[model samples]
Target: MGFGAMNLAPVYGRVEESEAADTLLAALDAGFTFVDTADIYGRGSSEDLIGRMLEKRRDEFVLATKFGGNQDSHGILIPGMGRPDYVRRALDASLSRLRADHVDLYYLHRLDPTTPIEETAGVLGELVEAGKIGGYGLSEVSPSTLRRAHAVHPVTALQTEYSPFQRAPEEELIPACAELGVTFVAYSPLGRGLLGGTVRTAADLEEGDWRRGNPRFQGGNLERNVSLADRVATLAAEQGVTTAQLVLAWVIDRGALPIPGTRKAANARANAAAGDLTLDASVFRRLEDIVPRDAAAGAQGNESYLANLDK
Candidate 1:
């Protein structure tokens, strides 16, 4: 139910325009009508790719995109969301690149500590009035910040990193969303590919790859994490499915949609199929015992991640 463009472009590789177009078509064919992207991903390349691909079937999909953090009027880098002018200009540029009159879901990619949340919400609400966005959302926000934003407007969803390894959201954010009638969008539900047991060691990571810098996948932490994945694999074997399927099923079981990103068509199909894997109560209990909240081997992220999230 969650499809995003964060991993499709320059971060993974310089995707040829032709291949990129094919991927979008493949997604649509597979019933993934909701596509998410941020202005910062590939500095707008991902949105541009989506724009081109949707020319023929714009009515067939729900296009979701985000703005916030720093970017020029044209969506080039600046540094922070300092004022209302920044929000207006950023949305204008995103709309232009996406080649759409309005986005179905617009999100604040990060909370700008320097700017008052009220002021930010005011501008986003104005966009909804101007027919530039159909709905608004927040990412990585705390329960209090979510309340503040919701008071400003009806927040349709709250996007956060949620998984067995990252249980912080369940502590407060998930319940807050439920109370506020906001859909919970769980990003990185596969634990950055760890639950799949593909990244066996630090050597398996490519130099300069984003996963290398991730604390959960580093040093002895990687080995310890794999031990947990082995338990998942065992459960999957009993069910006659892949570990990835089991992990995804567990996330869906938790009442949140798991949005994982990958470049391979086979992987994408597998992920979508996991939405159908109904884990029995016994398997779910076994999973909770094997990878409880504290069993995760490393910090979800260091101070940098905390710095980026809403307080």
Candidate 2:
């Protein structure tokens, strides 16, 4: 299992440093062998925190980090930068922040429209050969883009959102990755806490919480999605598992490695236990009947962010 480090940062909400660190250690103790992070998450705070928490036990986990997003001085993600020179600088910066000589996997956080895929792949290949990163992957990219990059260098994985609420990847990305022999790494498999049956209304989110602006959580959409979540919760209750575990089990059964993020140690343990739950075909059919593909209320992200995703 993998642990997503995004929520450990203050990006989602105000996170206590001690609590976040404890949660990370708890995840490791719980048998999470892979830990994922990004440079833009919390404006580099995610990597810095992981560096501090895993400094002594770095070898215990397979570290995966991403680059390419350009952030301003204030930590706002502006756009993607995949130029050759930027690639080298970004990797060096990430290595320094991670306090590690190399990462198990390095991903391009987003496609840089300004740079050719071949050029980006070439640089990543060089990094792999130079022993800076073991493998390279891409996030939120299309099959065509993956093919183009793979032609230059093999892509180890494709990190994207994949949940009962977000099944867009199954239509193409998943099959493409399978055919290419590249692992499909799923992030946000819990639908950003929606499928967990915890967020019922806007009031549930803290001020400046990013999900507040998500279309799925706004207006009539929120009510509709919550109704769907309630149905899933009922099914989970019947199966004697948390709603999060049921959803994660479904994702894992679909052949994707899910990296669910949480801020609490209890939540981390709960998510880690999900890997052991085996959902029967009856449960899968029931879940499918409850949450059909593309049944979500809105797009996975807002317009500006959606624009960056490879079509």
Give the candidate number with the greatest TM-score. Answer: 2
Model 2, runs deviating above 4 Å: 71-80
Prediction 2 TM-score vs. true: 0.97
lDDT of 2: 0.91
Q: What TM value does model 1 have? A: 0.92
Against the true structure, what is each candidate's TM-score? 0.92, 0.97
**Candidate 1 regions with alpha-carbon error over 4 angstroms:** 12-20, 70-79
lDDT by candidate, in order shown:
0.79, 0.91
Candidate 2, 10-101: lDDT as tens digits: 86778999999999999999989999999988878999999988999998999999998764555344544888888889889998999999
With a 3 Å backbone cut-off (N, CA, C), the pairs that clash in candidate 1 are none
For candidate 2, list the clashing residue pairs, or say none.
none
**Best-fitting candidate, scored by lDDT:** 2
